[model samples]
Structure formats: structure tokens, C-alpha cells
Target: MRRWASVVAALALALPGPAAAQDPIAVPSPILTIDQDRLFEETRLGQHSTREIDAAAEALTDENRRIEEDLRAEEISLTERRGSMSAEEFAGLADAFDAKVQAIRAEQDAKARALASRQEEARQAFFVEVAEILSEIVREEGAVVILDRRDVFLSADRIDITDQAIARINAAGRQTPAAPAPATPAPDPVPDPVPPPADQ
Candidate 1:
């Protein structure tokens, strides 16, 4: 009976238990990777920011087109009257028109730079808002570091957290509010060139 009991015990020890029978548990990597570009581009906050910037750019384009048309018409009118005026008077008007164009161009250039700055601000804000979620992921994964995927030469696909991050951002309903559109001053209408005094 003792021999029989010993045999049974040995058999039990040799046989795989329920835990061993199951698939091995995957160990989380201490180092993780994320695609920062995808994290920004695919996230709700990023999308919202992009839309706002694009709308502003489109509006600026429309304004530029209208201003160009107005300037073109003014130029034609000025040219038509050139034949009636002395060269000196025409030169003065021409110089003034050129100066006005330069001023408008400078103003528009500044606006374009502001738009670029706004875009950068939006990107910075996005990262700031998501910092908490990223921290949580790092803790959950037991990761010591999260490297940008672009910086790594080669890495396993499983380690990338960009898609996961995007999903979390969506789930959290994170969205950037539309920034107030910059006030666009109407392009000053080119004043009608004053007619020259009648020759003596």
C-alpha cells in the first residue's frame, strides 16, 4: 500500500499542472517604444488642432486673393490716368502704390508667422495634456523608459504604444479647443490717385 501511494505521488509530480498546461505568460518589457508623430497625428486633440489651423490658413488665402484683385484693379486705373498726368506726378503716385503693396505684404507675412507659432503652441499643448496618460502607461508596463520609435533603429512591433496611446486619447475624449481666429484687418483700399492740377 505504501509503494502504491508512492507511485501515485510520483505520477502526480511528473504530470503538468493546470498552470503549466496553459500558455506561458508574456513578460512586459522594461523598455517600451512609441511613435510620437503618430501619437500626435492620430489623436483627437491633434486632429482638432489641425482643423483649426487649416481653417485659418484657408481664410487667409481668401483674403489674399481678394486683396490681389483689388490691387490689380487699382493698378489698371492708375495706368489709364498716366497719359493725362506729368511724369513727376505719375512717379510719385507709383512710388506711393509700391509702398502700400510692401506694407500689406509685410503685414501678411507677420500673420503667417503667427499662424506658424500657433501651430507649434498647439503641438506643445497636446503633449502636455497627454503626459498623465503616458505616465500611467509607463507604470502599467513596468517600463523604465519610453523611447521614441523613430530614434530606434530596430524594434519589435509589440513594443510600440502609439496606437494604444491614440485609442486612450479617443476614449478619454481629449480634444483641443479651437483657438480664437486672429483678427484680419481688411486690406486698406488703394485710395484713388489724386488727379494732377491742370497745366498753366
Candidate 2:
């Protein structure tokens, strides 16, 4: 019985055993460094961000100019009114004008806050897309590890995959169109004119 058991074991071992595991079943995973700054600079997100900022700046400038003109006009009107009015009347008018000025400033502040929030949200989305691209590259290359090029002090050009990564990222980005900006609401339409009263 022991000899029969030995023969069975030998047969099992001789049955070709998964072709001997060709190359030790170990994947060669090398660290990949990417120049993220360069990638970002060349990306669509970067271009979009730059344009958004520039437009915002121009809008702010125009707002400022409008406010300045309004203030100047108010000041000139107040000067003329003050010269002709009694002290009590002048004081009341000045208070009303001051309130209007404060309201304008508040509106400006709210607009600024909204702009900042939108910009932050867009920036976060941009980074998330970049990270996804990096992950995809790591998987495709069979890389077990990846390091940011900025963090490393020395790396051979072969290990640097920034150009390849950027190409892939751009290709991926081109696949999806960016969401369209929200449309401005239309102004309310004027009501139809009421019929004139009949002659009394």
C-alpha cells in the first residue's frame, strides 16, 4: 500500500505543474516620477483657470470704475444740494446717500465671495482629474509605486513619465467636454399697458 501511495504522489508531481511560472511570477515595478507642475501648466484646466481669473479681474475693474463714477456723481450732487438746503434737509439727504453707498459695497462683497467659492470648486475638480490620470498610468505600466517628481531629488530620464502621462491626460480630457457655464437669467418682461381711464 505504501508503494502504491508513492506512485500516486509521483504521478501528481509529474503532471506539468502550471508550466514552471515563467519569470518567478514577480512583476518589475519601478518608481515613476512625473513633473506635475509641467503637466498642470500644459493642461486644459490651467488654461481655463487663467482665463477665468483674467475675466474676473476685468469685471472687478469695471465694477470699481462704476462705483467710483457713482460716488463722484453723488458727491457732486450733495455739494450742490448742501449749498441750497437748510442744515436739517442736507443732513437727511446725506444719510440716504450714505445708505445707498453701503448697499453697493455689500453687493460687491457678495459677488466676490461667490466668485471665490466657484474658483475653489473648479480647482478641486481639476486636481481630482489629474490624480485619476496618474492612477491609470500606474495600472497600465504595471507600476507598483509612483512618486511625484517634485519630491524626488534625483531620477533618470527613463523613470520620468511626465510627457507620456501628459499625453494620456490630454487624450482623456479631450474625451469629455467641460460643463457649460450657467446661463444668466433673463430680465422680467414688462406688463402690458393698462387702458387709459375714460374722460370724466
Best by lDDT: 1
Q: What is the lDDT of residue 92 in candidate 2?
A: 68
lDDT of each: 0.82, 0.66
Clashes of each: 0, 0
Error of 2 at 31 (Å): 6.9
TM-score (all chains, Cα) for each model: 0.74, 0.56
Residues 1-200, candidate 1: write the lDDT tens digits.
Answer: 99988987887786557777575437777888998888888887888988888899899999989989989998998899889878988988898888888877887887887788888778888899999999898899888889998898656666778888889888999777755545676666655556456578
- Candidate 2: which stretches are off by over 4 Å? 1-39, 140-164, 173-200
State residue 102's C-alpha deviation in candidate 2, in Å.
1.3
Taking all chains together, the TM-score of candidate 2 against the true structure is 0.56
RMSD for all candidates, in order, please. 14.1, 16.3
lDDT of 2 by residue, 138-200 (tens): 888778678878798554455678889778877776432333333444434433223234346
